[model samples]
Target: MLHDAKLPKTLWGECIRHAVWLKNRTLTKVLQGKTPYEVAFKRKPNLANVPDWGAKVFVSKKSKSKLLVHARIGRWVGFNDDVEDFEVSKGHRIYWEDSRSVTVERTVVFRKDEGKVRGFIEVEEEGVEVGIEGEGSVNNPNNPANAHISNSPTSPETPRSESLEPV
Candidate 1:
């Protein structure tokens, strides 16, 4: 953890964040199929509803006292029907590695016991943790983003980085 270990946060809370990114990507890759939500709803289903793998979530109660039901919302970023439990969290900020730095955190649950009958997820956008690091290390001399413009580069942009290299 970036905290318990008294880790002063890596160059950017490096350990937990880095490990999570890899895990999320791998999960996204593996569950690239029709999820149960989709099968139940009878459509391909968009994954835009799911939150980050371990972001904190708070389930509300009628009690005025501030006893928040803390949990993590851990779902594979893509689609998967087999998993039924939405991992609840009282923990962290969520992010999208593939979708730029757009982020979200689960602040409250509008429907606590709606079960499968209730069909969708929603969350509030609070503190967004932006990953300052680019797609790769810039320190590497061979890092393409830092490459010099060349005379004979392929494609339209010579020595242009992948962002400009195009698909």
Candidate 2:
């Protein structure tokens, strides 16, 4: 699904792990009509916490200001293992000065109809050249390589290569 959604390679493992976890908790033939989670815990798995991975989500505003924005837009990343909260990340960081951190929040609203939020941006490693081969590569405007391929308004006749070559 990650490849189909045009997500970056870096996210493949995370996506796969989440998928596997869900599959384990869901009914499957391998479990002999019982879900692995149910068999292990002697109870049905609570799937309500599961949200669409990479989906656009709105986290409830926790600020005390009267002019509250109501919610902050973020991308649903995964479930928090130690809590009931869902893990979410704000694209482009919360601010230039703030460290990029995933916020675990219980109040989340998924925007399923708006399409999956595969808004992950790739930050180019220092000294790595970005751009098509032999094009005097520079740092991509969309960050490492073309992170906006899936979000681009125009679709190319041929799928563009995503591999990066060292400068």
Candidate 3:
């Protein structure tokens, strides 16, 4: 939103600062004497291929899980801001389950000259019936594996209606 709202890109700056601080205060002192750059370099060299913070990511599918083939690509948002999640561009087909986070890429298909476009997704209207076993819903039911939770369930334990709290 900060990007789309045309707001100054300061949000990303604060995010970077927080990340540097968090690195120093991790649960373990694994990098006790080493600097972040040193530790990162030790782990892997030639970080040239590293993409932009919010560029885009498309994690390939594995044997144990189903893939949202149509949504194979997703924007590379920042480290998650609200939750422990890394930041990601807000849009459809973004959801995390268990320890796995999966998001489909968001793209606006537009014809430059004619200004005609279509939103494309990996979902299939006619073909393989891909079903995922999880507690979530797909934005486009045609693409089942792209998971999302519609809303919290209202149970007898919690009131269905919300009452305003004193401000």
Candidate 4:
């Protein structure tokens, strides 16, 4: 997995740990299709939060200035055993964040060379509205009706459904 992801040899330990984690969750012939994790934990392991090995991750940086970049770029290394968090490698340090704390946007960037692909993962604020140049709002799927409501004069204004004042 490390070699395929083009990760450095120094991260061999992290790669091995991740491999073991995956192996435990995967079915084996010796176990008659049941995973080792299922046998030990008495339940199926959840793979929903698993990230691609060595994929670029944009983690939210804590205590940052208002004008500074909100995220720090890192490499997806593995998972934390104690909590449901992702272990990311940033320079010489390893940072982990609660899985439920942030929203993720994943995208695949294709290289000029065919068959070469790279994954980019970004963590963004939940419920935040992002607007395209002229395509309208890109995020906030919950409010689809407001998608077409833009800043242009021709676009109709959207009425506020909620109040900011204390009730």
Candidate 1, residues 1-167, lDDT tens digits: the string is 33432323322444445454344433233356545444444555444454433233343334655675444332122122123432333323433333423233334442243322222233336443322344554434455875864546486745635555656
TM-score of each: 0.22, 0.48, 0.24, 0.49
RMSD of each: 17.5, 15.1, 21.6, 13.7
TM-score for predicted model 3 compared with the true structure: 0.24
Query: Per-residue lDDT of 2-79 in model 2, one digit per residue for the tens?
Result: 665444566666577668778878898988899987898788888764566666677777788978688877666566
lDDT of 4: 0.57
lDDT of 3 by residue, 1-167 (tens): 33542323634553354356455434345667555645643542233432333333444433454643533433343333353433244332322222335344344221222211223323355644433433442444444565454445565465659999999
Q: Flag regions of model 4 displaced more than 4 Å.
A: 82-167
Candidate 3: list runs displaced more than 4 Å.
1-14, 17-36, 39-45, 61-70, 78-167
The number of the candidate with the highest TM-score is 4
Report the CA-based lDDT of candidate 3 relative to the real structure. Answer: 0.40
Worst lDDT run of 10 residues, candidate 4, spans 107-116
Report how far residue 54 has shifted in candidate 2, in Å.
1.2
Looking at model 4, residue 23 earns an lDDT score of: 94
lDDT of each: 0.38, 0.58, 0.40, 0.57
Candidate with the larger lDDT of 1 and 4 = 4
